[model samples]
Target: MTANETIHPTAPATEIDASCKLPLLALLVGASIWLVIGSVLAMIAAIKFHAPDFLGACPLLTYGRVAAAANDALVYGFCLPASLAVIIWVFARLSQTVYALPLVPVVAAHIWHLGVFVGIASILLGNSTGFAWLEFPRGGSILILVAFVLIAIPTAATFGFRRDRTLYPSHWFLLAALLWFPWSYASANIFLVSMPVRGVAQGVIDLWFGNNLLFVWFSLVGLGVAFYFLPKLTGRPLYSYFYAQYVFWTLVLFGTWCGIPAGSPFPAWIPTLSNFAGYLLIVPVLGVLIITVKTLAGAPVTSSSDPTVAYFIAGLIAFIISGITLHLVAHNDQLARITEFTWFGQAQTQLQIFGFLAMILFGALYYILPRVLGFDFIFPKVTRAHFWFNLLGSVALVIPLAIAGYEQGSHAYNLDAALPALRVSSMGLLLILIGNLLFAGNVLAMFLSWKITLVKSIFSAVTSPLKAVEVKS
Candidate 1:
């Protein structure tokens, strides 16, 4: 093939280095384990509402325990590792650097995974602070911080040692996310643990950290993956690089202070600042939408075959949907009537967790998995099953929760009987259980197939009889 044909001049996937695949593999394994465990706990937590009498007596298996474990696993277990995988890939690609020693990244991943194990265990033991998403025990938080620093070290080093002289729009998003995590985490730790902010300042710091978690950690990482995979999948250079650039810049600048899902009750300045910045998210949202549309406008046929593309596309839609919902939900008065520690809050989290982050991770895995395993997916049927189970299960689980939440919140707001409100919400909890079962089955099937294939290959190398028996079947 000519140099132009060989290099895949238009699409960006052609040049992806194979050596960068291992770190991604380790990360995905961690994510998959977490995803399965997290979703199951989420369902268990949801179900306990209806059958409060079911495991209510068990301290370790209590509703609070499961809820904390579920959210903690989802955040630290799935999202963090998965996003790091994307970061590894993007850093390698933009750096035009191959992994001279892949073991370093792998070691970093092991450290992160260890921290996740400790955090989940700590939370499940009822050592949490009862905070949403930041519920990991103090000891767990320290371990997680150490893990974060370890992972960030290689990323920062990659940036400094990069081959690509000019940074891409995606690079800005990645860097911003890396920076935001430490800032938000540190502030949250200080406020929630170290000094313990007093009165409204506590609420203010809580709002700041929560908003930062959503905008910077989840959205920034999601957007970064989108920025990379969308153009790469469409087989086009980024469309209107300037617009993409503007989107990245605006998001980092204005998306910082908008996390008052229950709205702020502080000084006028607090709410004003948060609300104003929340509205400003539109600048980046609209800008990126235009860029994505332009990039995918005339893509190659190969785009359809690429799971990465599909996943990236799904995440982009989720990001926009969540962004808009965030605005609608940020009204303190409106949320005051709706956010009564109910599933309504969990619904938005699901959108951010499963809808935005998980989808992107799926895309990242779709591309990274086959490359690392030295094979195409062992079974397309299993792959499709995994995707559908997660997609539908998330909707099935989240939608009913949202409905139940609204019912509970509306009733509570009007001073109705709490028991009746709880009873009504119980139905949604049942649906979540069914959804989790389906999702867990799908994940098990996918991993089992891979395991079988690997085992079969190993035996076949020793004797053709093993292969012949399989062929006969």
Candidate 2:
């Protein structure tokens, strides 16, 4: 097919449509709920940073546990399921086939959520593993792994049975992510739990796993959505299909190696390798930026009325900014100055997860929801509200945290001087909380409108029968 040739739209078979709709909706609902919950928890955590005594009386709401729970909920609970929904939809669309074993993904989503719920509960109950991303207890981790497999099975089958002979860039990225996540999750769990690494090696593994999960899994999924939607929405072909290959491999090979140096007692070469990987990542970032800019050339810089286009552009810009920030902070001198005991690292995390990945997913959901539901959004204003809230909230959140981190780092010796920065960061978190509330409200409105329509249809069906009988009499 020529570069500009759009994929032919195929009408999904009735059975296929029926099977996929509920599961996709379920994933969406689950993700939105988790987003709100995570936001609340995060707000509490951020507040505690400045006001340490706000909820210090409650053991269950301790800062450490609450922070861990919030992170876990946002990552596994919101982003994972949301990304899966997008991936499954894109896969089915590209394959020109209906999803098989629809119930499997739905069941798996429930199981995954259950696992996260239990894990967070465990953390609150003081059973956390204390291993950063692997804070979940062994049992919860096992449950998640199993759930992942269940979700992956149907995903693989969909790709395997694809009708189209040619694969798209989105397909490659999505497939790689699906494969990478399981490997990374299982490997990390094994090293951290099943067999258990020793001493500084544990830290090495932990950092490696965290970095890989962010770059290899989450970043890839976000990029894949961008690749598909950018061209589709703009009515343009990818600028260079061949360069997309370079973007993919560079990220897969080098991205996995770019872990934060933990000052561990391991061999010196490990940190060196990671630093080198971090610098090398600039290659893929630039490649993606070039492709995106070229593809979007001649398009409006921002379409305020179009949430999807606006969000996509915002996400792409954030991705580039985060990339540059990461490259700078990964340098040896910068790492010593900012990577640890500061909010700098947290800022980077927020930029990547919320700014880039979540924004792209939001755009994808806005695009996909209408297509699947077969109706226009009931509250277009709410959609616009969500976009503005997210964009403004992210800016309000990251900038202060980054400034605070730098100030706090520079004044490391004077604990009293850092208070102002902490308070400023707290204000940023408050904005994030407000933004999240808007998002949750928007999602709830969409579902409520759908439910109202369903109820009206059912009532009409029942009443029409009586009217027909009366007319006959």
Candidate 3:
């Protein structure tokens, strides 16, 4: 085991065992493939809705099924596993113990991925119960839940058994995210799928789960990665433990109860509960933002050197934008009407996925792959291509959708109008299709490049002249 210095000036340095970084690469490849597939489905749904004649009347390609599949692939297939890759790395780094049982994580990853496959298949086949996010049939839901339990429990156990008693801010966020899933998943499933919670309770549970998934799962992963990389990039400890703690508790307390109070029949108190939480989130968002600003306040050189840090910073900005919009929508019913359906929601989702999640993962891959494969990015041009294609496509897809959503919602609230809003919305839908296609192309190129490079290395005589050697560092 090699000892590594703690970034914090006050904390003692710790040692990390020599562990094979296999699962990290494997999970990343798996997630990337899924993202490509998910993006294709997204484009298909966008096209089908915009042009009914494009796909004819194929039952398999129905708008609803495709849309559901898109969400399923993105959530279950890509985001969760990618985030888990980061989690595993964090656990290993924090623990500084050699990978005791790497195969366990591999097994966990396989079970979870399989569960996602079944869940998506069920949804596509119209076996869904039609609840947002919880649309997987009971049978599928059970499998997915079992997978979640299998993965999450061990992850938590690993964290609990770590020798490091002094927890980092990133650890706090990661642990919270891990704990949050089981609770959120169980609550939503129990209400929407099992016995059923009627009326407002159902809506409340749904909103609760949705918001928690974003904050606890997605947001935590983003923040944890940021926490790790930012320090590593700057070669300094975080500017303030005080600030991070404030943000952490504020996010935890507020994140759990956010996302309710829009025209639902649920008791006024439910949204009121969420509204208070939403408002409180502003403190953490601003506090964390300030901490970020202070920490990197003078480190532009470092930031430029690390695209992952840049992506993370951008994601935080996006998250703040989403957080503010969420707060406003939760409080004012009229504003919610306008912003709720508008491209605003679309913007939020895109910002979180692309600006935050995708960028962080890309940066992580860039940082990790070299070590794992003992080589630099095979083609820097391809990396740039991936970044720009996805970046521009994301902006193009999300902006129109947000604007279109606003137009549709405004028209709906004002006069008896469906056709006019639908017409405008169609334009936004078209943009989404174009953006998705571009993203798909970008991802496809990445995979092809990865595959070709590996093949060339295996048979160098027929491929490039560059020698291929196993990474031994």
Candidate 4:
């Protein structure tokens, strides 16, 4: 094929990137609102750990309910939709096609947001299933699932009908994640809700679903965004396309198995399989880290000046650290000592979800929003502040929790020492709340700026013709 034909098999009919602008904005806005709500719930839950009597009067804000609501809000409400938006955009760009059936995703986004709202409300009302991430009731879960399918269909079609035949690394990650989530989600719901798994198997299913949700869905989306943006932003090609393939396949093959060891009260071999899989994951994790370093070897690391680059790099490091931590904690020795029924598990969750996945989303938004909206950030300082607060807040949140977890685990036989550790972790939660407040503030500022600019433009457009007529008269 000629070069021209290879590059442009089919010219785009419309600006593919701009087609989903409204939907993307809506998703981001909804996600930001949920981020704040989740932060508040998290703070309340954290406080209750140390000061059980603080909000003891309100049953709705009880520790268990609030914690479940917080997790639901962050995972389903904020991260899921935000990641979907990013993936959709990436798919559209790579396919060189406008988002087919654009209104479907827009409507689906609203429904998904409503579903999350109702789901959180259900949890707060004491209707929680007590499952890890599958806390949403069956009805709510099905609603979100249907809405997700609506969104995913068009994305899949875009991939299928792409202008280019060869796929990028990001494309593979995006496609795999989008496909994996629905199956995993449906299976979890079916096992946990529709046809209940027997005693020990229920826990196994829950752990499997929850961990896969993290590794396969959230982590994959983060890595996909990193693959697309890191090289683009730095004006460099990936260090090794071959290594990228290795990273993708390894994650796909091994990611699901790593979650099996999460204290499934099953037979010994089950945990052994999980531990071995977790150890094997180091190969891909190290490959990703090496690729990142080599790709940005000479590139100046300016996360401070460029929030997107900064967050991406921070997330990459977090991913590596989380991987190593997962491997170590999965070991039989460490699992027996540190993991079961301790804050250490929570620490790992926060590190992976917030430090790694959410950070990448933050960076993706920083880079994507302006281009999609056709404007620069109105308040650059707010963006920078958001980054710093998040960085510091995540560090504060994870480190204290890790320390507290170690202490709690070491003294598992002692209850008195655990209380003090809980208090220390609560302080970290306070920092996280503060950081989330900063993020909310930044998002609000951006929205207000956009609204103000839009109103001014409309006003000018309306009056311009009248002024022209007046000058003519």
RMSD of each: 6.5, 3.3, 6.4, 3.9
As for candidate 1, its clashing pairs are 211-259
Tens digit per residue, CA lDDT, model 3, 225-327? 7777777766657767788888888877787788775556776777677777876777877876787788777875552475656555656676666666666
Give Cα-based local distance difference scores for all models: 0.69, 0.80, 0.66, 0.80
Q: Which structure is stronger by lDDT: 1 or 2?
A: 2
| Worst 10-residue lDDT window, candidate 1 | 1-10
Highest lDDT against the true fold, candidate: 4
TM-score of each: 0.82, 0.92, 0.83, 0.91
The parts of candidate 4 lying over 4 Å away from their true place are 1-14, 262-264, 303-305, 413-415, 419-421, 448-473
State how far residue 225 of model 1 sits from its true place (Å).
0.8
Model 2, residue 262: distance off in Å is: 6.9
Please give, for residues 1-473, the per-residue lDDT of candidate 4 as tens digits.
Answer: 12212366353523775776867876778888998899889988887766778788999988889999998899898899989999888788777777788888889898899889888999999887788899989768888998899899988988888888788888888888888888999999999988988788898888889889977677688888898888877766777788989999998888778877544679888888987888788888898899899988997666444557888888999899888877776655665466556677788888877898888988888777776766777665666677777777778778777776777777764545566766776666666666667666666677778778889999999877663435544
Model 1 spans with C-alpha error above 4 angstroms: 1-18, 261-265, 300-304, 331-342, 412-473
Ranking of candidates on lDDT, top first: 4, 2, 1, 3
On the 0 to 100 scale, the lDDT of residue 14 in model 1 is 36
- All candidates in order of TM-score, best leading: 2, 4, 3, 1
Lowest lDDT sum, 10 consecutive residues, model 3, at 9-18
